[model samples]
Target: MSTLDAWTHGEHTHDGTTHPVYRRGTGPGVVVIHEIPGMTPEFLAFADEVVEAGFTVVLPHLFGTPGRPVGAGYVLDTVRRVCVSNEFTKLATGVTTPLAGWLRSLARELHAELGGPGVGALGMCFTGGFALAMMVDTAVVAPVLAQPSAPFPVGPTRSRDVNLSPEDLAVVKERAAGGCQVMGLRYRQDPAVGQRFETLAHELGDAFVRVEFPGRKHSTLTLHRQQEAVDRVLGFLDEKLRA
Candidate 1:
């Protein structure tokens, strides 16, 4: 893989702070939200692949809680602060809220930069619902949610309530009804994501496409499964975004 500097870099003003964002590629825009690892090497490779597939991608540093930059690899400590203390989901939701506005601004700017309609956004496990949240941004035409995990507060009462506020869900639901396809990926074993899909399916009606990677686990659907998880996700994105 080749390392290319983000053509655009700036402070993403969100939640009373300015976080950094890396923008690369030269086609349609794709907002690539990283996993709990921040912008790790693997996630960067995923971003590069999306770029190679002909889409500009933006990687956001959602975990900006001091000393936590992109690719920090502070997973253990992150767990303590985020998961154990439940602050991780809180931090993530804060950024997810402002991200929709940031994407719209980025999309408009990128459209002038790349000369296209707008951008496509991909949110992974820790950030899967983020993509759904950004669907309210008109510039975000194509949205893909991959293994959305966290705050499994979904049931008949809170299914579409993970990370996103109720207002965001209503708007995104409207977009899906108007032809925006929300494609979701998850391993049946990942209960958090499974519950997410269950709730979202109802609010989204028939516009949501949830694909379960059989025998796959919580780890990217690559663990314990012979099938390649990356290939499956890429194919799904290609079908959805590569139009």
Candidate 2:
């Protein structure tokens, strides 16, 4: 049985593009974007935690088979698809992924419906930096980036890139300066995450909350599953959205 069976499913269409969305829980709204290779059981478990924490959680099905467990072959296949997809910007710097616009639209609609200060956006792994990109929109108040690996981290330049265009980065910086805080979590030695956390600290200064765990693990909220990180994320959402 798929864990998603308990959630209400729907489709969100924006600018002629549409994607399946799974929703559950109630209270404030949160858009939880899953990592590469689809929304695995672990990912759904994390979303369940968010839902149980008192927020209405929305999981956007971007790629990969929903409910599929993570495996080497599955990861490779999904990586290939994401690399070829026009919606994602894999090896490029100074540009936000096109899918972020769709995600921002979803956040907007959620905030509009919930009528709170704003909604929260959390992205993990390959889709990690997306939360920061969505933060460009005012609808996203609590933006959490968990092990954001983007631009492929091929070279030194790409390794440090946060996957945001200069224009978008500028707005994010402005928003950060205006009291909007961005939270990030990753393993201290995870090469997949590159130096993006350092870049974030440099770019957003104190507005960027950096959370690092010991050792080398990729997914902070899911696969790696750090309890402290999860608590930090939930606390951040509560502080920014409910408080």
Name the candidate that leads on TM-score.
Answer: 2
TM per prediction: 0.75, 0.98
- Residue 208 Cα positional deviation in candidate 2, in Å, after optimal superposition: 0.6
TM-score, cand. 1: 0.75
**Stretch of 10 with least lDDT, candidate 1:** 86-95
- After superposition, the stretches of candidate 2 with alpha carbons farther than 4 Å from their true spots are none
For each candidate in the order shown, give its overall lDDT on alpha carbons: 0.63, 0.94
Give per-residue CA lDDT, model 1, range 1-243, as digits (tens).
223354466566644555577877765667777766556555666677777877667777665232233433576565455555422443333234444565556555554665544567777766677777777777676677777775444453333445676677778888888888887777777665646677778888789876776654664632232245556656665665556
The deviation in Å at residue 212 for candidate 2 is 0.4
Tell me the tens digit of each residue's lDDT in model 2 across 53-114.
99999999999999999999999999998988999999999999999889999999999999
